[model samples]
Target chain A: MIIDVHVHTRLGPDPHGFAYLLDQAAELDVTLCVNSLSPKDGTGMPESPTEDEIRRCNDWTAELAAAHPERIIPMWYLNPAHEDFACRELEERLAAHAGLQGVKLWVAVRCNDPRLDPIMRLCAEHKLPVLQHTWFKVTGNLPGESTPMDLRELALRHPDVSFFWGHCGGDYEYGAKCARGLPNVYMDLGGGEAMNGYVDLLVEHETADHIVFGSDAPGRSLISQLAKVYGADLSDEEREKILHRNAQALFDQQKPANGAAS
Target chain B: MIDANAYLGNWPFRKLRYTTHIALLDKMDALGIEKAVVSSLENVFYKDQLAGNRRLHSEVHPHADRLLPAFTINPTFPGWEEDLDVCVQEFGMRVIRLHPNYHQYGLDSAAGSAVLDAARAHNFVVILATGLEDTRHHHPLVKVPDVPAEQVAAAVSAYADVQFLVAAANFSGVSAVWTEAAHTANVHFEISRVQGPVGDIEKLCGTVGADRVLLGTNLPLHVPEAATLAIEHAKITAAERRMIVQENATRLFGLG
Candidate 1:
């Protein structure tokens, strides 16, 4: 079975909604591992969601994961742009959701910005794997969206922390080059319309161990993202690492029982 | 399954994994893809685009039965009728693709209207792409805009007699595009850009009806297995799956 590391809440509308997401994962025999709690819509929050909106989205995500602990793995989303309240927010959420395993950084600010330093230090202290939304768009980027290169810099700065580089920055050719030889970064397979060398190129540069599977589902496709791995004609060992092993290893590092933070 | 939206030639910005027909055939054979309706990437950049069509003929003719070739024309070009005649008469092409974004003209332009008239007269399946690549990641200097879904919807309604194959259909704000055209029987969509299991593919099938959806991978550019698995694993019925995978394409392309 495959583990999807990059799913969002409220994938789409149906009578079932989130229930449908879990049921479909069950039907497809996929494990719904990690989620970026945006809202009912699969698209993430407005680049910088209001503090109250952020609190509400995270609360909803925790409840959804709690209902299906066997299937769902929840990530704590942080918007460092709320620089004044961001650190306090993380502490309060962590105290509340003891088992949250990962950290989600959306496009509100670049990962390397000084604004995120306190957040990064807190994650490093907690051993949380940060899944940052990084894309290099040609048309343009969001006000402060990070790119693979930005993540690469952040990875070098925080060597002990694990980073799931979301969508490999869209253009896999450039993304692969940035990820090559970076042991801390794991290329996320999600969101973008993948091409012929999406997996092979990344594996050639980063190897299968450094690459993980993520279905930006509800907004994207689960099977389609899974097929990016399964259809790569990889060996069993390579497939296993991407399908579940790498993600499981990353998740295991989180200090689940030690959620206390001032 | 038949891959209805594969491409050949250089991408200009980046090198493709497969740029030749031999590689495509080997891939199709391995994946059990019987036939693929293909267009040219090289043509989109060319001034005449007819050269790219001629190049495609040379490359695909050897495996004609399996590689169903489609010709592209810049309908805005003067006397495009002669070019269409060549593609139809000399090349025996059955599909005429348009890249108004690459060709730099509005789909509602007078020249665009003339092409629609030609499409009605020629009775060839007209394949228009919502986009070949995400404009967000396109070369910043190129400044290519996507063919808005509403524009495609408008054409589908106006050219009621011509078969419109919307390739790489954009799912973002799709209602404005596909839902508008859903009422028409002449419009069909290729799933090169659509995904499933909560990606709302079933909703698309429900709205447009299954018979109007065809399987497309945008291959040598996208994963063939991904396209096949999307329908196989979609929530729609097996019969809907069957229609999406091959039957719809077989009927649209007139494959015997």
Candidate 2:
């Protein structure tokens, strides 16, 4: 089965959003892992959310997972800068909810930041996979924006936790290299700011099992994102691993420890 | 469905093993792209624009059944008129693409105007290569900004008699040129990189007329089925989908 390891729900509290997303994914014959980051706050300039807003986002995802036990999975979208709240929320939610699949980190803090240490430790205890947003080829060497190297640094520090490099390093050629020797760092192929041969290059350098398929949908085309995997010249077995098996293995390995549903 | 935009040749930044015209054809067949209007990377990279045009025409001639040549014409280049004539008169090329950003000329410049005038006289469809890749993720050594929307609007306004297609434009690029795209009847947009939301195609069509949007995949640099499948699965009526996939491009390119 094709499991999309990355997707975002419609921003804000629209009760109908998750249902709509599930329906759309059904058309492609794939299940979804919806990151509960509101489009309004998840992207653009990062805004600090109140504790209530954070709870609301996580709670919304938890509820969606409850509704679709078999079709949809939830990833905890946490602002690592709010370490205490993030840690508390993960503990609270994962304790009660077994379907919460992984943790998603965006530009809240660089993947290499020491501030992320506590959150990383917490995820390690729970054995939750970490998906960190990464990009390159943009203006302004912004302080908090994580690069492939930054992600590599963090993955090196914590060999136990698997890191999904979002956007495949977002136009950075070195993304595949970051995963070359690191068994824990896998790449999630997504992003429009990509070049041809990007996926092919990744497969060549890192092998296919270390990569996962993500659409970054609503903001991107699911068909297009899948093409990044399907269009690549990989064996059926390799493609299957990237499309579903790798993710299934990662999430499943953690399930017995964290008690998430298979 | 016609792919309004596609490409052949090497991208300096990334390796695309399928850079040959024949390789593009294999890809086209696999993706179910009936016809593709293509430009050459040589046109954007080569200093001498005419040489690039000749190379593109020569390369695409054998595969004329599925591939249609869209020559690159930089107005600022010397002997541009002759090159335009060669593309039009000699090669019978109907489509001409301009790289305003790469050519280092504004759309409103004398050079730009002269090319537009020649294109008008010769009855050529003009495709403004507004963007090659997203500006945010461009290589650090070579930063190519997208052609500003205001410039596109100005050109569209100036050349009201000419049919203009904005190529490789994203949503922001569309917004920048939305007024011209909506107001100017001759102005059209190609969706090679316009992605957002679930029903973004319907949203764009709702904002602009469905008639103005054309199918583009930015192929070789992008996966062709990405756009083709996206269009096929869009939440629009059959008629609307048909227009975007084939009818609109067929009519615009005079591929009757």
Candidate 3:
């Protein structure tokens, strides 16, 4: 019942890096992958993806999930900059695909921006969780990128919406401290940074109640990232909460009863 | 598996746990790693690198069956040869780890040549640990960049006889530093740093040949399981997996 809450498929047709990830998940007894979209050349997301690009990437993600059936769960990718389009396309994508579970926010816009308000509002309406890609890079970050401090501000604002902070911010010790006391924010252990001791910080500060499994796959080694949790010093109860329970609760919350119309 | 890269002692940036030699071996034991070739983390920061080496030998010697200690040689410092001798002749350490970036010396410095000469003279396995953690996440004061792979490649080309292990380098390092083009065998890339999309140690094995990729967990600073599980999950052959998991490291470090 392991669910890798953070995973990526190629943008268009899936030429490189997907099969091995799928096979690794299957072999590892990982029941499902909550997959987002990225590029085929191993490059990351565009800073500002156009509306059509978002739709195209989401379409490809849905197709990968459909082709794989229960093994894949598509996470809708939305650039909050496309707020009106995001609110519109989110419902459209939800109505079209039933298993579509969460919204993935990459670096196109800072998670704390007012532009994200509408998307956050819509997610709260739908009870959907948002996985925001975050890093506190010593190198200059991208223009619209959100640091853990910024994410904390967002989490403080949107108390009802569950936000899975991706990569737990690169310097997770600092990031976890920043994320401390925010109950609605769950740190996704997905950064391929693979450094030690951050997980313990998450446990001490955020608690296992706020931890979830993710592998930042294809770009990072799935097992390496997976081992971030598997290799950490945690109790079985805490381990289960991180590996599946916490994520399942988030996925379970995304069920919209109104037939998915905007 | 022989985790050819790991550390013992404190890091100034992060409050590290599980860093004692016993904790490290226990971690390796839990991860099924037979031995770990470890260096002193404090050595990278300490100006008197020999003191760090002395601490490492003191910490690891009692657990020599499971822990193998390596000396951190700051080639820029005076009396480095004396320190190297004390570590080898007294502490009985066979591995030498160099931190050119942290120590602020070029890989082509006379100090570098002198260390290589000592390495060749002593038949020691030299490790170049350039990437400790991603520099982007360094402590505000400790923003050290990696020694460029080209520079290391040139050094590798220059000293064909020294068995070198490039620790914590990236996949581009595999391409630029030790690729099929080099057709070189004297150097090996530690696995903890070789990351990317489409990981199947097969891709690396296909490119560099299996003999050149060594398993190193960068333990205490990282998790040992991540390195071990990477080899377990790769789409490589059993023989290739064996080579990556332990064989390459065992042969490189003479850990028969």
Candidate 4:
């Protein structure tokens, strides 16, 4: 089954609404998609979404998941800067929606900001996986975006929490290098730039297990981006892991079969 | 079926994805690509135009029937004339690729004009590669400065008698350059870099005619399936698709 993890719904700034996105995904034969909330910072915190807005977005996702059932898996977007509000909303969403898999954070906040500790602690307590938007300082396009070094610091800070670095080996080769020994951290291959030697990089570095497939849909086409990975020279087993198994395994670990919260 | 713009070898900052030649070829072959005019990643990084060119030529030249070598020449190199001569004479490179931003030279400069002349003199087809990735989404420090369309227009005007291929250029860039150059009979636009829901080749062909658009897969860097699908799914007639895919390139590059 083709699953795209990095998907955006009309819950935020996208001009294209949720219905349009769903229709496009369905047309593309996407069985499963992780619909993430686009962050909003009315407070002028650069890329962070407001607390009330985040709650509303999560509520909308929960409603949508209820309607679609197995098709859509809502991934909560949280800004740790909102401290207590973030934990409250996370707990509220977890209690409200059993289908919700994990949390998505745009670490565009700042490299290793201490305020994020509470948010990571909450995820650790709930056993929820966190996907951070990561890149290298030099190669990353965004001026204020967090680098792989920042992600390494964040991973080291919260060793028990499962952190998935979004964009995988994007432009920064150092992210792959830093993620080699860190098992708790996984990388999503999508967005920004395409790396020249991605498959061999994963194999030689022995970080194949940490790599997962994600297409920053809308910004890119689901079919075309998936084709890049599908057409790559990887073993069937390795392709399966990157395509679906790894994501399923990560999500399953966070929410076990018993329907327990943690 | 040779793609004029393809890259092998390693791009720094990322792990070497496709290491061996067979590994790269097998992937390209799956996409229906028969032969590719490829350059080494080392040439892109160390700026050692000839060494990287020779390394690529030596590896792929033995299998020249399958892999055609296109030497990447850095106009910034002090001994660029000697390098260009060696590439054409020793390796039989008929095509040369230029990375303006990567090599830190303006295509409008006097030196760049000389490089163009040298390429024309050797009967080599010049391919100007615009941007590898979208600048908005690129690494902040790895700035992909636009390959000035006016400079390309000026070059086309300067050498109306010679033919050139522009790879990774957008629709607007193609249109602007072609319009200014007036006589675009000698220019061919490589379609891998320009993408949209609508087929760019069909649209461009309607404007610039089918003969000016050719099939190019920035393979390894880009997936060929979508581009291939775009050409296949275009609104143009089968004859036109054939022209864009094979006939146009065959005629322009003298591949037949």
Return the top candidate by TM-score.
Answer: 3
Cα lDDT tens digits, model 2, B55-126, are: 888888887877888899888878888777777777898988999999989988888888899889878899
TM for chain B in all models?
0.94, 0.95, 0.95, 0.93
The weakest ten consecutive residues by lDDT in model 2 chain B span: B194-203
DockQ: which is higher, 1 or 2? 2
Residue B153 C-alpha lDDT in model 2: 89
Which digits, one per residue and each the tens of the lDDT, describe model 3 over residues B28-93?
A: 777788888889999888999988988888888888888888889998998988888898889987
TM-score of chain B of 2: 0.95
Q: Model 4, A225: alpha-carbon shift in Å?
A: 3.5
Clashing pairs in 2: A11-A39, A218-B197
Instruction: Give candidate 1 misplaced runs (Cα > 4 Å).
Output: A11-17, A36-44, A98-100, A255-262, B196-199
Q: Each model's TM-score?
A: 0.92, 0.93, 0.94, 0.76
lDDT of 3 by residue, A228-255 (tens): 7877789999999999899888776655
In candidate 3, position B185 carries an lDDT of 68
DockQ of each: 0.57, 0.59, 0.72, 0.24
Please state the error at residue A255 of candidate 2 in Å.
2.8
> Would you give me the overall lDDT of model 1?
0.78
Worst 10 residues of 4 chain A by lDDT: A37-46
What's the number of clashes in each of the models? 3, 2, 2, 8
Error of 3 at B202 (Å): 2.5
Candidate 4's DockQ is 0.24
- Score candidate 2 by TM-score against the native: 0.93
> Candidate 2 falls in which docking quality class?
medium
Which candidate ranks first by DockQ, i.e. highest?
3
